[model samples]
Target: MSSVTTPRYADVAVGDALPSLDLPPVTRAMLAVYCGASGDHNPVHVDLDFARASGLDDVIAHGMLVMAWTGRVLTGWVPQSAIVSFDTRFLAVTRIGDAITARGEVIEKFVDGERRCVRVAVSAVDQHGETKTSGSAIVALA
Candidate 1:
């Protein structure tokens, strides 16, 4: 487990990497629950038969759910109040039983007027090292 603490502006620097977050495998049961909660009950994400008919090998996890796993990594390391913006793009499909892990690196840091901010390049990859999502975020440090 990573140690979580409030970050100070003066202590942060470029090139630092946030600790990686390894999420549980995306199972059928998990997909069913996410489908109901997110109202994204698309057959491609919850029904294997429909997914196969749609040309997918099996039901896939929601893209937003993978993004949320990445979000968990960021929020785990930094307070939500310090976050300015977070965004991502889906790169590849995450199928059932895939274990996604979130990773990030500090790409830049700057002082905007009186506010100190840091930019991070983030990604979510599966156990096989295939990148499923990629994004960047800017956070203001206190």
Candidate 2:
């Protein structure tokens, strides 16, 4: 199989934008599968009645699930081995049926030890343009 080629450090610049990833709408089945696969079966994410009882309008998507999509955006732009660190914060709940889009932009470039690295600002937004997750990632360059 052919391996993917990512941009070199010398070719990348601060303020460059990473490719965005648009995911399908959040669905109950997706939540259920993620819950099982990730071992994060929180009632708030998969049980509608439990969510309503907890004062939520309906069951919400798992925060990590959304974060994973953001990670996908990063990996899609750069090789997974180039990633040094990644982190995210949940800004808002993701409801079922909401479409999520993951985006990222290079914010800075620096050297850490012998590695050429870039810091990227990343986020995931809902169909309504509300940010549901925000984060940053550090990636080493070839």
TM-score leader: 2
Worst 10 residues of 2 by lDDT: 1-10
Model 1, 84-113: lDDT tens digits are 899999999998788988998889989898
In candidate 1, position 118 carries an lDDT of: 91
Top-lDDT candidate index: 2
lDDT of 2 by residue, 30-117 (tens): 9999999999978999998999899989999999999999998888888898889999999999988999999999999999999999
Over 4 Å off in model 2, which ranges?
A: none
Judged by lDDT against the true structure, how good is candidate 1? 0.88
TM-score, cand. 1? 0.91
Query: What's the TM-score of every candidate structure?
Result: 0.91, 0.95
How does each model score on lDDT?
0.88, 0.93
